[model samples]
Target chain A: MELYHRIQIQDVVRLDHAALDAVEAGFRALGQGRVVQPPILSMAIEESNGEVDVKTAHIRGHDRFAIKVSPGFFDNPSLGLPSLNGLMIVFSAKTGLVEAVLFDEGYLTDIRTALAGAIAAKHLSRHDSRRATVIGAGVQAELQIAALKLVRDIDTVDVWARDTDRANAYAERIRERFEGLTVNVHGDMASACREADVIITTTPSKSPLLDAGHLPAGVHVTAMGSDSPEKRELEVSVMTCADVFVADTRAQSESNGELKAWAGKTMPFEVQELGPVIASGQSPRTGHDQITVCDLTGTGVQDTAIASFALKRLVA
Target chain B: MELYHRIQIQDVVRLDHAALDAVEAGFRALGQGRVVQPPILSMAIEESNGEVDVKTAHIRGHDRFAIKVSPGFFDNPSLGLPSLNGLMIVFSAKTGLVEAVLFDEGYLTDIRTALAGAIAAKHLSRHDSRRATVIGAGVQAELQIAALKLVRDIDTVDVWARDTDRANAYAERIRERFEGLTVNVHGDMASACREADVIITTTPSKSPLLDAGHLPAGVHVTAMGSDSPEKRELEVSVMTCADVFVADTRAQSESNGELKAWAGKTMPFEVQELGPVIASGQSPRTGHDQITVCDLTGTGVQDTAIASFALKRLVA
Candidate 1:
């Protein structure tokens, strides 16, 4: 009997970095127009213990199912378990066979999201961008730094979290990890945004985190926090000031973020999509002074593409 | 990497008698109200060569993906490939883990379907049923014979097909396989149904094959074909004589078959669902002189339940 291979969750955890690289390739594939990601459907399970979020993403061309399970895995530091855990199944489009099973839970998610920010920086951030300001010193914040360094030659990074000690620890870790990159611990959000070329907001705040008054004209902001309707990370005025705005999925981002906040108001710029422009080589990187904002609403297509790519790697 | 167990298609070939037994167990599980199967969503892809069907079944308690792919692998009669070929995947519900993958495909489908007929026979057929007639001399006909024998003591089985040779071959095979089970090759459809205690139809016919007047009193007919709205195997008059009618899914059978044949017209009896009856232990066997009919428009729940069962077997 010939043995058929089964890829497991442990495989996903061990090879998350490689999966991240594969996801970058997936983004490039999306840019090359080989992606069909539908808006994710989030189902909330109200449990007595706590609320569990089931995030489902369907990727058509890749024929994959990526469902994310989030129960605030990181918030409870005593639990010693990551707050997010999920599995992905990549199916064969030719036969509808579930080719491989991946249990990244949230590792691949963080990687893919951080990659999206990097991709956004590649097309939206200035060419000579050196300074970085990341709001929220969490797991995602760490990933953002790692992903940004790959796409930009950043020399200085300002780390700011609600907890001062955690923020300083994150800054010290960043400086230690990347020897040449200077890291600063900012006391407030306003000061962090003042001298940064690229500002990333990943906080789970209802109100604005970064003041629009502190942001310079040419700074490109990648907002990654506002996934749910109530979670807003950037001020409405910041969206108004950006020269060009892009979103992973316009319908999803609008429904979740800027549109949810400014329900009755009209924005200056229409939310352009990332797929067509990236695929058509018509990105918003015309000049260094373009103030672009990319709202990263996580998509299933990326999950499918990444899972498919990784399955091929596992098989090959 | 440690190698897991390997089950090849060849290793499981000739699963006939044993497979039928497994199918009986599955049906009993259904009868015992232990299995929960949801409705299936099937997508038919018609190609110039032939057609392919992709059916997906979702088991609630079992987090496995069961997909049935029926390609036209048997159309080339010269090549001698059987018409149906596919596989099933059983995943672990607890960990969302894919535990085992089986290549039984059509073998399992045939057994389970035939077991459904046997189940119908136990509840719908007369206690003194002695004669059985099965339309369609294909593999499913053999399954019908196998499953019927398990439920009834003595039976003279009549076989009918498009080709006399095929029908005769099937009759000869049944006789040789079942030993004491008497088998007869019928030249015409009407003669096959005449005085038959149980009638099982498995042909992929677009029109009805059995006439209502041909069936004897107390006959229980298992309509195995006409899963889709475009396909049906029993005449409208067949329902007129049916004392009590049952369907796998009411919505599916109503839109498709004798139900549709009598659409907008008043019917003698409302079709009871097999699931509810099995669940509630209320399967009514009218009487020795009352005709009964079970219209099966196969549901996804069966697949899910079966797959879940198979996964449990693999685990054990």
Candidate 2:
């Protein structure tokens, strides 16, 4: 029966340390087999060049669970509208009654997604990681860097985009946000990845945008763009060449992430998941020179976790 | 968003002719390939013995579409709570923006489900059908009869339930509701179905409850229960014995309805969908003695159609 708007939700929940811990706990619970998440339900409106996805999950002991309705209208920008917007409904896990509806317009998804990227870096990236590179000049690019600051000592940042002007704009925004941090716009992706201790791919590209040659030694990559079957950011070799590869969930990675490229083929490496890695308290990085990559197709557990956290903050 | 509760929604949308027409038009649009519906998104909370399903569809030209979240906590009734309840979110098809939040607590689902049964009867049943035998003495049994009265002259009724006391109570309620209508409580399934012009199965029975021998000659059977994979009402022989079998949607029927029992086996007859039957302007009932059966595994299109209809009524 409670309703919170986008501004109210944004005021209460942020990509801060507490939020990161909450999201990490969700992954830990998922790894411990205490989370019940089902495959996402997505519908396409071809007439409007739109897609809407519904995702929900219940963590065993949470007082409430969340069902997120996400709508992405690709063609809406032509009419001067935001491309992505939707809300989340949280219900009591006990009585299955509505507790709150967060009309966040996708803000919480952005926060939780950024936190997942940072969580991957925290567990997979080199401990002293300082330089980070982000592909895609969208809101997530900025949010990812902000979240990474909580997990790693990321001081210098590199920006890469299909559009050079957007990349420069992204660098300018990052420079203004972080007081003494260094931000540079890279004209080419290869130069951007040259010194990156952590690389985050956040684009909506439909084809491979990152190559095996682009990743430097000891660099960790987090690809969060390809949450749908049609999108991919890492080339097949980029994932295969890494010393370790982890997915948010193996099923989604095979269907909607970089691993879909290797659909019928058996992977040469033992693919792990972020949750299990977090749960085991073992870093995927064995040595300073080991390269790691994490694929995030997103999960319902993240939605439920973030929404529950938001509700707690709102009620407080 | 505009918010309406169960009472206001029930006051606006009923088992009336106009509501049925709106739902039928949705099926027509679906049959004509103008509907965009995705497979349901379902999640189970085993700890609470609960299940949640998210269903949605966009009928191409409609101004608005609907996403319905239905939750069933089978264990809730032990604590004096209703076993099924949830809400629907209606959005603009053009802008993908939320227009209303319908806190109908599953009333809309009931109304639409009942109307779908009546719609099937209108298209597939005999024109002079005057009797309905409902297999379960639950809320749906009463709603199905109320909706069936809109299309067929269902004056005589037979009530059958595993619980005899509940069946007797259902018969009493029916007698009181329909003036001068004969209502009888049958002790067994076959005896109740013997004189039925139309038989509606509306139970949550996991195993087969209705047998092939239970159906009388030329009877049109609408099986509305068994929406989940674990539930089935009619024996496999009951479906195979029908001259023609119709489903709300073939995919749902095969996966979640009676057809899952025949998973790999080839069917003896062509299985058609109710939407296509409604669209083709043809009845599968070729002869007066032809037995017809419909598997009513509720569909996303019906939810979208009914929610859209309810939204209009509420706003008016």
Candidate 3:
């Protein structure tokens, strides 16, 4: 007899530090060349203003893997529906029988994405970092900061948005969530990153938002908003000025992330991957005066990792 | 405010002639260049002899599309489990919201594949064809013969299998299904095609089973088994002898079907697609003695079409 399990969003919302660690381990395995991840299968539904992407990865010696179907329809919001929704289908790697279906409705994607941001901060940001800057006032802005709290002692936050009212509202929510932390709303991106130990960009802008002049010495920048070819968060000059630059996956970074501006051009510095840094137990940012940048375009390894983690927790 | 409907195998078993017609229309659309189908995403799990394939297609101007995940574990039968299992997820094209999930196992695949064979026979075979020859006594052998009855007046079946006992048993089942129809078990493939109007091969042999010498004049052959690079059901000589050669898709046929034998080699004929032939309302087989061959490698449009058809019936 065959058995199937369906895990809903409520079950997945309870993820914690353990889930973050699981995703980090997936990155480590990928850096060690122990995972098989294929190029994403993307299809455009032009009439509906929608796109669907199928992603999967197999970790060597792992008992299970996941195939995630993620679809985004830009017109969904007008119909009173969320723009992003889909599920992850998990199968036993040994027998290929479906072990479970995570009907997360994009919750797991949010969790894994935020956790990836935290993973980058943990390996590149200063250990005693207490001030952080967020470049967007959306759902991801809050989640990315919350995830960073797991790895650092962040006690102050600087928020910046294209609209002042949205930024102020975002600051109020942050103050309510973190009692003793100070939340300051900034009018410009330059002011928000001037004095912060870690800066994160979470906007879906088609043009570059942050440049080299916006960065401060000894700061770590995590660009999490650009995950498509049309999106860019950091300028090419910013990447070139940084002492060290890392990517979640070099191929994805060059195609869809902040590094896209420098895609076919050669650079003076060697590009490092986040997975190898975590696996090797070394921080690329060795001094307090060195600038470091990490570009995350997401990977299938993270989906398989997070799905496996959620299944274990829900089943238990 | 999200709703999900699950249609099980029991619900899909009620499919009738309308479902077959819906799939035929999908082929017609594909032939007219009104469908956008991405290449299939396939992954192999070597340890368990398992492979997973993700197929999807968007029909122009349709309200919804489908993404089907099909997994095959060859070793499952040893553990008393079915060798194939998976589901189809359908999303609304207007809003990209998942409208339904069809947990029909592999029933939808079986339905679409069998209907594709019927569609090929409908457009390529002689209008008065009455006798059919099936080269393998598998589930598809029974389904193909049954589906062909929708377009032709098939009253007699010649069953051939590697094992004579299985062929005899298959003949018995066909006799019970269609009263007053003559069914014969043949020991060799040549004898089965000696006096038949339509021939269908449904086996997983890693070799050539039928050659030009096995085919008689005016016979239409539908090879539905060789869906992988290592599998072949017909020899190159048979294709060279046919007056018209049709493929479900030229790319897939060249890689995983009987056409693989002619890959990288120049052929005397241009390969036609089944969809265009049906849409043009013209049969390439001009004379009663012309030999026609169709290699059915399957396509994502069939999955989307059949899933949409099943959802309409189940909801009504």
Question: Candidate 3: DockQ?
Answer: 0.62
Off by over 4 Å in 2: none
Give the runs in model 1 whose Cα sits over 4 Å from its true position: A1-179, A182-273, A284-304, A311-316, B1-111, B163-165, B203-217, B224-245, B250-271, B284-292, B295-297
Top candidate when judged by lDDT against the true structure? 2
| Number of residue pairs clashing in candidate 3, backbone atoms closer than 3 angstroms, sequence gap of 3 or more or interchain | 0
What is model 2's interface RMSD? 1.0
User: B158-214 in candidate 1: lDDT tens per residue?
Assistant: 877889999988888888888787888878888888878899998888888877887
* Best candidate, TM-score: 2
Worst window of 10 by summed lDDT in candidate 1 chain B: B41-50
Give the per-residue lDDT of model 3 (tens digit) for A1-316: 1222334545555436888889999999998988888877878898888889898988888999999999989888888988888888888887777777777777888889999999999999989899999999997899999999999999999999998999999999999998998999998888898899999999989999999998888899999999888899998888889989999998888888877787678766789999899999899888998999999988999999998888876677
Minimal lDDT window, size 10, model 3 chain A: A1-10
Instruction: Give Cα distance to truth, residue A58, candidate 2, Å.
Output: 1.9
Q: For model 3, give the TM-score of chain B.
A: 0.96
Off by over 4 Å in 3: A1-8, A11-15, A262-269, B1-9, B12-15, B262-268
Mind giving the per-residue lDDT tens digits that candidate 3 earns over B23-77?
A: 9899999999999999988887777888888999999899889999888889999
Error of 2 at B263 (Å): 3.5
